[model samples]
Target: MMKVHNRPQNRCFFLFFHRNGQNIGFAMPVIFSSEDGKCFIMEFCIYPEFRGNGTGKECARALLHWAREHGALYAELNYGGDERRCHFWESVGFVENGSDAWGEPLMILPPTEDVPITVEILSDPEDWQLMKLENGFKREIGENALTGEKQKQLQQAVKQGKITFFIARRGYRAVGMCSAAKCYSTFSCWDTAVFEDFYIEPVFRGKGIARKLAKAAQTWCAENGMSSLTVCCAPCDENMYQSLGFDVRLGTTFAHLE
Candidate 1:
């Protein structure tokens, strides 16, 4: 019989797969972090005799399902920059997002297949969202975007409903984000919003995530009774905005105070 066990002190568990009372494979050091709802798959192995014809994939699928069922929001592992290994994990629905604190390459797998890229309005900025937004800003603007104090201020503003934050999530990770600043339009005599800081991580770009974020923001404006949503785009981005149903009516320029 196959035996299962857990090490509560270390928050680690082991899963063994067997057939006909013969051991086939095992996943060890399956660590769970309740603080972040992340499951860490440290090591997975199949016996030499059973290492063929989809056995590994099958075991991996089972392991992931178990992880999700046991309160794992997502699963992640380090792949050590191996192309073959990465491809194998990709086939099992893992995406190479970023690396770990140790600088090792990492991949993330969402809990289930139905958790497609989703965009949601952020009423409160969580740690994950703040981290992803910081990364997005650094990539797009070449500098840090939200510092701790700034984030505190932003949290208060978000709670007060002074602005809205839209985040695109691919499972447990925040892959993209944008914000809308509420304002009043004298011309329209109604409340309006200006969309800003739209960005998706480079790994997640070109997947229509940008459009989804924009659409969510637009929908929020409509549902909240705003007269319109506006975006000030550079000349290069004009076509992209047009594709998202934005019309160019005037040329504008800006100057930064010294």
Candidate 2:
């Protein structure tokens, strides 16, 4: 059944379609009033099988007509993350903006070969210290450091089977740290840092410590059923990461509200 939240004076309609005994699609239309007049249409979706059959365009046109009848001057729908739906929305007169609302560049990486690395799960206090030292390199690059609270949260996540952390070391000195987290259907290499402090420590630098650490994380991710691994870094660090065989892909804009 279609769930429609309707207000007498200012209303929005949610359309749901069912066919052949299967629930297939739904849409949400939002109405807004401003000085420029009223605007409508917030979101829409259709199952893949039901798409491209004129259902979406017809529904959009009907929604627009309803909005205009209710005194709306403009109707808009966003295709921000749905590349497949761009043409469908555009066919109904929606225009693409060069920038997303947050104005961040979008990037994507398809499945690729996972590069192997050797890593050890840190279990000792000394290992933690080494991990901290490795994280300092990220700080130097203006990357955010994992806070104490976050570390604790990650520890809990690890215990709860959400992620795993690996530390690469030479003798007793920790040289690198990598952490991978499971995100629903995929695993993400959350953090991989090789410390400058260890870079000049004579025994850790120039010895593939970073590579080993990365491989260890990859191994853990694979062992836990992740078919691929992904990580992101500053644009300038792309080369360094790519040299390790990470298929570099641009990422979406990152923004924070103050």
Candidate 3:
């Protein structure tokens, strides 16, 4: 790991990891303001020697903090379909908004805020209390979603704090539910929160309730001191999260090494 410092003179900063004694990587973070808000313009690159060493990710976090401190409403950047590059940015909290004229990936970090919904984090979620979650997963995946394996294992994991279950209610009925978990990123060495099991009743689908629930989940994570919040969304679900100020996981795919 390399130490971070401020270079207010040039509107940029320095990072040294692979070649500490020399000027290894230079990341000049810029923020531009618009009538609506401000966008963080990230002008940066890493030396070949420091490419895979998480140098870019660290610089990104530092820049975002700078933007937040400067009252930036959002952060934006443009990228291409480079899987490695895309992964690094997404894992660091940048999502693709759209492409520029050159077909590059445009990414942004929207400000996080609460929604107009009443939600709570359950400390002890029993089997009976999991009815909404079970049904929601079944509806999204299939009816036999729980036929093979019991959900008790996951329930215990929630109890152990590996996951936190959130439920949104109208009066007394649970209308929406989301499962938030802690995601540890060894690259940035921070816990990035993720929303895994997010579902809202079909009747409540178009009422902006989903976004409210999402915000509630994020609020919980932020209160717990998480650096960023991420949601694994499908193509059809992209617009919803985007409307709620979340970035689309462009050019990103998941894989597990055995």
Candidate 4:
């Protein structure tokens, strides 16, 4: 369904477009009442099944085009409470400005380019300090160091060829990590890999670091002769995974008894 509607009284307009016969989400385009009027996005959702196929980006480009055509004094959008939700805004050239009417955070999308990211496999002893720093940010950790045994265990795993941990860095500091382990998959009848701890610190969430780490992991998998790699993420992270060439799968959950 594709429709364009407006409320002349409130000066609000919406543009809805759904593709692939999936009528699951909404896309809102911005408009203004006058040349000096401001434009703000409410929210635009691309259904899970349709994400990462340029649908979201296409909608965002269209919204910006409409805003430009209407001579919007400025384009604004709510970033919601989580900055992760603002990744698309950042990718679309939006930067934090102020807040929208509902007190939700807002950003302005000026024409710009993506930021460069650097990722590498962790091998140096000094890099372990950065790993501990990253772990300190975990909720259960609260700035405390990992157990000494735990630290040694991970080191042994690295030495035994059991796991590979890739880290993303900003100059001298480690910003995030994605750890992978070789494993067997029954369906594939071959060796596969499992990835976990694909985390980016809150400060680094929207800078395309995740994609860089994923690329490193994919390269490692290709070289290691693995059939495939499995990554599990919160539903919120699906777009990042999809852009890295992952097929998102849905499933029921079960707990194992000890």
For this target, which candidate reaches the highest lDDT against the unseen true structure? 1
lDDT by residue (tens digit), candidate 2, 64-175? 6766786665554445546766766667766542221232111111112232334577564333544354344444445555666755665566577555566664333343
lDDT of each: 0.75, 0.53, 0.62, 0.65
What TM-score, over all chains together, does every model reach? 0.59, 0.40, 0.50, 0.49
Q: Write the per-residue lDDT of candidate 1 for residues 66-163, one digit (tens) a residue.
A: 88788777788888879988998999999876544334566777454445898987755655555555554653555544566776787787778887
Per-residue lDDT of model 3, residues 154-224, tens digit only: 76788788888888765433557787788898766989777777776553457677777778887888889
lDDT at position 15, candidate 3? 29
Q: Note the residue pairs that clash in candidate 3.
A: 79-105
- Residue 188 miss distance in model 3 (angstroms): 1.7
Q: How many residue-pair clashes does candidate 2 contain?
A: 6
**Residue-pair clashes, model 4:** 1
Point out the higher-scoring one by lDDT: 1 or 4.
1
Tens digit per residue, CA lDDT, model 4, 1-258? 133244443255655655666564665655545433456676677778767776778877777777778765456666764767777678877776433222334566542323355788888633554444345344222334445576677678877878888888755446578878998888888989987767665545777787888889988998989988887766777786888878756363456899
State the lDDT at 16 in candidate 1: 93
What pairs collide in candidate 1?
none
Candidate number that wins on lDDT, 1 or 2: 1
Best candidate, TM-score? 1
Return the lDDT, model 3, position 227. Answer: 78
Residue pairs in clash, model 4: 94-109
lDDT, residue 123, candidate 2: 64
Off by over 4 Å in 3: 1-117, 147-149, 248-250
